[model samples]
Target chain A: MSREVILGDIREIMADVFDMDVDDVVVTPDTTADDIEEWDSLSHIRLIVAVERRFKVKFTNAEIERLRRVGDLVALVEAKQPA
Target chain B: MLKSLSWLRPAPGDFRDQARALRSEMRGGRGDDLGMRLYALANHALDENQLVSLARLAAGACDAGAAPAPFSAVKLGVFGDGTLSLIAPAIAGTALRHRLAVDTFVGEFNRAALDALDPSGPVRSAGLDMALIVSDARVLGLDRPAASRAAADETVERAFGQVRRTVEGLRPSIGSAILVQTVAAPLEPLFGSYDRIEPGSPLSMTAAFNRRVADWAADGGVVLVDVAHLAECVGLEAWDDPGQWHAAKLGFAPSLLPVYADVVARAMAAVRGLSRKCLVLDLDNTLWGGVVGDDGLGGIVIGQGSATGEAHLAVQRMALALRARGVVLAVCSKNEEAAARAPFREHPDMLLREDHIAVFQANWTDKAANLRAIAETLNIGVDALVLLDDNPAERMQVRSELPLVGVPELPDDPALFPRMLAAAGYFEAVSVSKEDRARAEMYQANARRAAALSASADVGAYLASLEMACAIGPVSEMTRARVAQLVNKSNQFNLTTRRWSEGELAAAIRDPARHVAQVRLVDRFGDNGVIAVLIADKGPDAWAIDTWLMSCRVLGRRVEEACLAHLAGAARAAGARALIGRYIPSPRNAIVKDHYRNLGFALEDESGGATTWRLDLDRFVAPALEMTVADGFLAPENAAA
Candidate 1:
């Protein structure tokens, strides 16, 4: 329900998708696709899909392509499901 | 796996939440695991609305060219007069259930009618197996039908003629199947006071169009995709989106894509020949009101006199209708054979007799084994059988042991049996010929031959004893339906599995350059009817057999040799140097793998798993047989009758 809670959920979903530990994955506004070892164009799509599925929201193709960092994804998900 | 399996077991709210999650993920991207997502969507947990929404998203993803769905590709072209791209994803979603990765070519809006038909277009170059005509741009806006039946007739006939021309114009390179959607009745509230939304108005015109199309499509490989029926399943209002229509010029609403996709999926499935050929039914409580053996024959309600009896009667009538359309019906019950046979013999209300059944297994054996035996006796694959039993345990047993076999659960009430079976769409046949109607009788003749074979010394002697007669002639109206049905349905003895519809059969019959012959056999046992079909293309110097197929019952009876002998004569008459025949082997039809060689056809060439054989017309000799041949064009069925 809160921003932090939603971010926490996003972390768990990303961990499952990338097969990494939630603790090993760090989130910040500067955390771009370059920051994640496994992140690429294909995996970026998968990550966006994973986040959308976990949060019950949709990201336009333009929005997905323009996403610059994990913080953008977190902010978008929080904005999508406001309390 | 457990998560998907348990997704449907949750309560309403929980199921909704789970379905939403899966659908959202499925739509977001990553077309991988589409098969699983489709499975989850198919579960009963999701309501119709939820399923439709998910299907729409899936269709969108497909439109954008989603991942190659780790599936066997089924290429298709969706062309229409209006916005047709919205439907691509839903079709892709539904095709996933069949394990078909759909690669779609969306025609330019308003050019669906002309795109595939233009011989030099990209659609023709796609090498598609099938194509769908999404909608006619003017169907909804066509002049409303007047009160008179004649007005309605004129409306539909005009539309049908235009559509027919488009269908017939489809180039040979457009692939094998052309799927046309029957125009749906428009949503209520047509503008203008005279445009009264009455049944005999535009609604009647659309319905009449569908009826005529269905009649015309019976023999033609042209399939009428019943989008109107899908519209009926969901409310007509829900199926249409005028807002989007006015805004995007979308001929169809985006919301209805899921339902429309379903219709496309079914049509595609039938075209690919991915359908069952037989329905194995269980007796006891399934076919009658009670257990026949324990309750005695009279106690089992199956007559037209009582309420419960009528329910069982409906199931029997449905079976009889299916049988009439060439869907084989067999009985698999857990009871004594005598007890089962007694009901058919004694009950006056029994719609199905022992003659109607292709196989009757009424032993206490495991039903799974019984179902398999039925399939084996029929020489069809296990995947081509649908078993219906009242007992849940029996359904579960068949489901677990024979997963390939379809086990459709009937409602608790026996009256719903007919409705349930009809809705399952398991026996979705593409075409039915007079031969199809006589299929049960042909199977009976085979049984008689089997009996005679056991009594005779050898197979050759048994064949010789039976006074077999072969009618070799050009295909006639009476025989065209049977010939096309054979071409479409016969896989085991077919040389090259090329399916032809009735329209093509007529075209071939009229073409002088193509020599087509249909063979009908009748022996001592019974009338075998039209059991074989042969089509050959007349080249300048050679006549090549484009298609050669025979009923399994007539195999090993020298039927193919006799046909070839007659073809050689015809070729010689046409001033051709030789007759050509080729064998393209498949999962079935291995019986005829060496048929060309056995018929004295020299191996002309072999390439790419297909073997081509040639027979010099001048030196070819007909196989001697104790039979009579009715040569030349046989009269149509009606004329003969």
Candidate 2:
């Protein structure tokens, strides 16, 4: 799957978590925790769990901590996908 | 609890197809995994309304044609110190299995637990079945003075005193049960890790406090959840993020919420009395090493000498231990009845006997039919059964045939069987009542009654010939646990099946405005201990039956008639002008559709499927019971309701 496709799925998950439409989310490499209305500490954890379960991937604490934007999560998921 | 998750059956789908199929199901419906885990990824991420809707849709879709009312939600109150509000929604969402919905009351941040339990406390009227508390030195502001042993001791003692007082102050209304996490050891050093005296540390004091709480859990109303051990398991670095702690006062990191939710959900299930009641075992390779028919008694590997024999012996001993603690044991083997029972009777090393089994089916029939027959003979739903079989194919077949039967995966090695079964936690019991101790023998008596019924010409004559009698009275402490168990576990014969916890039952038994009784039946065969319970709300001139359920074993025996007669008399004696009963329709309780009408009660109202009936005390008379009554009997005319 392409990174855009993975990002689309992650956006859908984010939209569900925030109770918004998928199209309402506009993401870029710089879009981050402070940019989103619903992205808080607890929500960040839930988003990780949802994305990990969706992609059948596991993330390290360090990798999750390093993530600051949607692009970072998409890259981590793409890297962790089974080759 | 993995029911027909046929959607997840490794089909000819690629990874995307499988994921799409699962997502489609969740998008359009619920993904019922029988709560072994949360249904879908969306559940953890979505808010309460979305998650609960997905749960309900999935549950309705899973059980087709059986539109039972959505089960009542469990109410929980989370009262603690620190930033706990952020995690309440996650806990509530994670606990939503198909049959259970959890609603949480998150107390204000950093509120004291003792203050919450006060008379006008914020959580006083929540009426929670479970209350979760997270208290520690950091939450209580127990700062130390100049790093001395005396200061550490005083800090630990004060925190312990506060928590103990909070636990004592908690006046749990009726069904409320409290769960309190012990203090987590402070992993951080006061100043530096170097040259630290461990004995004078706060970590040592926290450990000391946890030990006392562990001892207190043995007799107190509070159940201790081992947060300190959980922190250790999660590892110190992941468990405590220094940045998050400093920023948000978070006790544990958000990443560990799933693990926390899993532990708490299981503890809640244990207290809610949702546990399996039967172990249906296949005799051939499951009980012994080889096929009973082909190998014969001596050839089977269940004797004292061989390693395989010892493995089989271990399984038998575990089954016997479970039976002793109220799990009914039965055998379903595909062989001649005599041939199957030969090892049980003849082998010197066999720990389980034919008497140990309440129902034994040894025929060439399919295993599913035999299991169904076993459940029917035992008068229980297939949901209450757990089957053990060594053969994977047989287990799969039974699973397909009866989705409700819990089939645990058995290891290839026979030696791992005992511990694997133990770790499954199938027979989790909150309290072992006196009636539970004699369950095995009582089932044996049931077998004799079955035999008597089969031999008699007519059912009524058989019932009359048995000289059966029942003793009904107020719920005493001796019978309170079993009464609550029956009220929770009984589904089919239950009219208005209401679940009451032991604390709730204890309170009801003492209230003069309420009427509660447990019925014990004794026949010529043996005594069936506390087979039924009935509760009613008593008013000035009217008494309404809140719940009435009888064991299915005595279903056709007119024991309910006798019970109603006794109720009418009691209502009249209490100056009640009328006795009323309600029949709320559920799929299982359809067997009791015309119960009140047949007993001469006039129909009062009917809405949707729920029906109410009333009996005027002036015209009602006690039904003439053939069996002698031991206690709680009124004279014939006194039973006027």
Candidate 3:
């Protein structure tokens, strides 16, 4: 899967977790936790769990901790997915 | 209204879609109506994530000051060795399913010991009715490998001492009860398969610790949240998420939070005397493999020799087990009563007999109405009955009509029936006394007495034929737990409906100003153990009836009249001028709205749906009753005789 597709999927999952409309969940490579008011540590963990479930992939503890932006989640999902 | 209710099966639509719709509906000024809808939605089988969403909605409702009635609110103090902030919302949301509204105070993380030990800590100062200490193996240091077998045994002892101190310290400081959780062992084993025998290993140490905690809790009358057993059921590997634990100090996997919250809430419900009492079963496709009306008794599948037959037998065995543990069984089948009776009477493979059922209603009528009749006959609230049916349509109809009645949806396979019913946690009991073992038999005898009452000429002759004998004594240690259970559970017949714990009852019993009576009745049918409990505040002028409650099973037997006669004589002998009584109306206790009035007490005052009554001793007339009475506590002269 392409990075764009992964980011789109992550955006939908984040919308559900944050209880927001998909249109309001606009995300780009530069989007960070600070950009969303509901993206606290708890919701971040929820987001990671939901994203993993959506993509059928697992994230390492290091990868989960190192995630800093929407781009990082997309890159991780892309790397885990089969080419 | 809850249009549909299903538990074991997946809910109708995607939970997110349902939750979002409910959330929007909540914002539309329909908070109270939508709040119950939300509760019904949350009662479905949902995962942790869905539970979190629903919890958010519930928290929002609370913030908006939307109050849901008929759910008793419990003030809870949650102290844990790990991060419990995530669990607080889950518990608040899940408790709604169990008919409880939990107001929580989550203590400082890893500060359970300090919070419990400190006199004015957050937990103690919160004035909580109950406190739950959540922990895993790490809380007791059992996560680490011990040096030697003797050291491991010593570790268990030390852990037990710490727990004992915490519970005892918090008991006196808290409002009512304490709940301690058993630690789940770590999944990773140092000795592999040999961990079972290796005493110093993490697995063995946790096993020893749990055993010690269970025994201690039983002896101390402290309720237990058995996380160790819950973990084992969910599988240790799935239960433990080392990544999340290291990240946020989560006790277990976040995925299991819904299940964990449910277990804890049910334990709280059991301690609060909110557990259900009856298991109302259906006939076709539920108790047996085939419909008895259509297939006949010979063609129906039950008992051994085949998989379907064995599955049906397992359902019967489950019902029998529940019956053995004080859960009354009743049948609500839509068939001819004769047809339903044929199997239980003559089927060779049938395990349950007609004698086992407390109220057998098998006529072709609406199940919701029949369920109401069953609850009436059994003398319990409709909420105390759980309907186990295989038809989804019938389950939905009952849910819409009588939402209080518990209906657990069955899976398509009959083999999973017992497991589904067990998972519902309807009959979650805290303690089982000898009285509990004989409760089903007592209820059956009550049915027989009812039959005999109808057969007799009049109420006088019925009482005469009963040959009833009564014994009343002080509330002693032997009767404390049962009395407390009745005090908390008896809703319809209770006058004051005051829920007093065993400790409170003990203190009351020791007080010079209080007279506590534990009444037991015996008739030709069987032993009705401790059917009535009365607590009166003694005064020089008059004795005030503080708590007066009776088992509804003994209603219409003139037992209440016998009790009043005994109390009147005891009070007069104690130099009291008169007796005072109060009637407080509850949703379920309208049956006793005119209780004091019917007993010939003059109404003194009325306010806020409660009325006070006074009866002068000089004018009191003790009516002649058929039963013989003995009052050894208040009338000590009778004891000496």
Please, what are the lDDT tens digits per residue for candidate 1 over residues B505-596?
89987998898888888898778887788899999799999999988777678887778777887788778999889999765677888888
Worst 10 residues of 3 chain B by lDDT: B1-10
Q: Which ten residues in a row have the lowest lDDT in candidate 2 chain B?
A: B1-10
Ranking by TM-score: 3, 2, 1
Q: In terms of lDDT, which candidate is strongest?
A: 3
Best by DockQ: 3
Estimate, for each residue in B1-641, the C-alpha lDDT of model 2 and write its tens digit.
Answer: 11111111222323223333554565664544523223323222233324423433434333333322333356777766656755566565545432345666776533445555566766676666677776755764443332666776666677777776665555453244677777656666665553145545666667666777777665435677777776775576667755556645667765566456545655665565456778998888778899878887778899688999899898999999999888899998889999999988988889998889999999989989999988888777776788888878887788778765767677778887876576445676555677777877777677777777889998778988889878777666656667877887677788887777667788887898899877888888788878788899998888999999988878887889878877888888788999999999864689888999999999999999999999998998776776876545343232211
* DockQ-derived CAPRI band for the predicted complex in model 1: incorrect
Note each model's CA RMSD in angstroms. Answer: 8.0, 6.8, 3.5
The better-scoring model by TM-score among 2 and 3 is 3
User: Over the stretch B1-641, how does candidate 3's per-residue lDDT look in tens digits?
Assistant: 01111254464466767777887776775555665676677677665566677767766565423246546667787776567777877787788788777777887534665676778776667777888877777767788888998899998887777776666667765666788889888888797999998999999998999998889677646888888888887788878889888888888877677788888888888876678988999988888888999998897888899899999889999999999989899999999899999999999889999989999999978999999998877667798899999999999899988888889878888998998788777888777878998988987887778778778999989998999988888876777878888887787899988878787888998999898888889999998988999999999999999999998888888889988987898899899999999998765688888888898999999999999999998998999888988878756665411
Model 2 spans with C-alpha error above 4 angstroms: A1-40, A46-66, A70-83, B1-72, B77-98, B103-109, B112-130, B134-177, B181-263, B498-508, B585-589, B632-641
Model 3 residue pairs with clashes: none
**Which residue pairs in candidate 1 have backbone atoms (N, alpha carbon, C) closer than 3 angstroms, thus clashing?**
B59-B89, B59-B90, B219-B502
Give, for candidate 2 chain A, the lowest lDDT window spanning 10 residues: A15-24
Fnat of all models, as shown: 0.00, 0.12, 0.24
